[model samples]
Target: MRTLTELLTITKNGRGRLVLVSAEEFFRLKSRDRRAVQPAELSDAELDLIAKAGMPVECAALDAEMKGYAL
Candidate 1:
């Protein structure tokens, strides 16, 4: 399957460049951009739930192993 970026059509214009996308894609992009400016904050209840449900054992093991290795 082609990604959104791959599906996009880009062309050089008189000014610089132009990107052509469908109305749906344009609105999706716009919504994402707006959310990026103001990210949502999690509520206290959500935080409590996350704290109660700790990381999975597999992820914990990976984290421990990664600590022993150099990046």
Candidate 2:
């Protein structure tokens, strides 16, 4: 059980990918049958950065995984 305040605190610390979501959206996600909120689709630029960081294979795998859940 994560409170909205804790979510905000984690985002502020730059610990994870941050997404701007409405309160309604947040609660809806919380009550979903699947508790995990899927990761956002990565942009070309972000993918390029990941590749440059020496993780081309990892980035490709991540892209493939995200394809399964199109937001």
Candidate 3:
């Protein structure tokens, strides 16, 4: 079980090969399904930075057909 930072480190370069989701997206998915495979927890600092960067995160990228699964 790696932390969010660790997971980010692993996926950072493979961004084109992996999904990069925001913390909000992660939680919204989680609430919809108890079994949803939400992304790792991001630090508040990171979240704040993202918000400050003027990029509003949208979970709309999530596939509706994609069911919940453990990460």
Candidate 4:
């Protein structure tokens, strides 16, 4: 028998009970009810900044990674 660690999907039944299955089986069932995922777009100002900087300039005030940066 397969263990819980080996299972990728655990869904609740009608009585709210848990069900376990392999990733392959989960995807096969998910394909029938799949939806498209969309990405968020950057604003015109953000795009211009990226173009001018030749890359992304993340400031400490705006990003978590640069939180400890002096400037």
Clashes of each: 0, 0, 0, 0
The candidate maximizing lDDT is: 1
Model 2 CA lDDT for position 53: 77
Residue by residue across 1-71, what tens digits does model 1's lDDT show? 65554445565664536666667777888887743222248677866886798776768767867786877
Candidate 3, pairs of clashing residues: none
Candidate 2, 3-70: lDDT as tens digits: 54344423555576567565966787788765533335667787688678765574776776677685
What does candidate 4's lDDT look like per residue over 1-71, in tens digits?
A: 77534654444563535667777767777889956443346677866886787434644445776678998
Task: For residue 39, give model 3's deviation from the true position in Å.
Answer: 29
lDDT of each: 0.65, 0.63, 0.58, 0.63
Residue-level lDDT of model 3, residues 1-71, one tens digit each, is 54443323235564545655567667767788755333357677866886788423575456454668656
lDDT of 3 at 36: 33
In candidate 1, stretches whose alpha carbon ends up further than 4 angstroms from where it belongs are 1-6, 11-19, 29-41, 66-71
Best by TM-score: 1
Assess every candidate by TM-score.
0.40, 0.24, 0.25, 0.27
The C-alpha stretches of model 4 lying farther than 4 A from their native spots are 2-16, 34-71
TM-score of 1: 0.40
Question: Which prediction has more favorable TM-score, 2 or 4?
Answer: 4
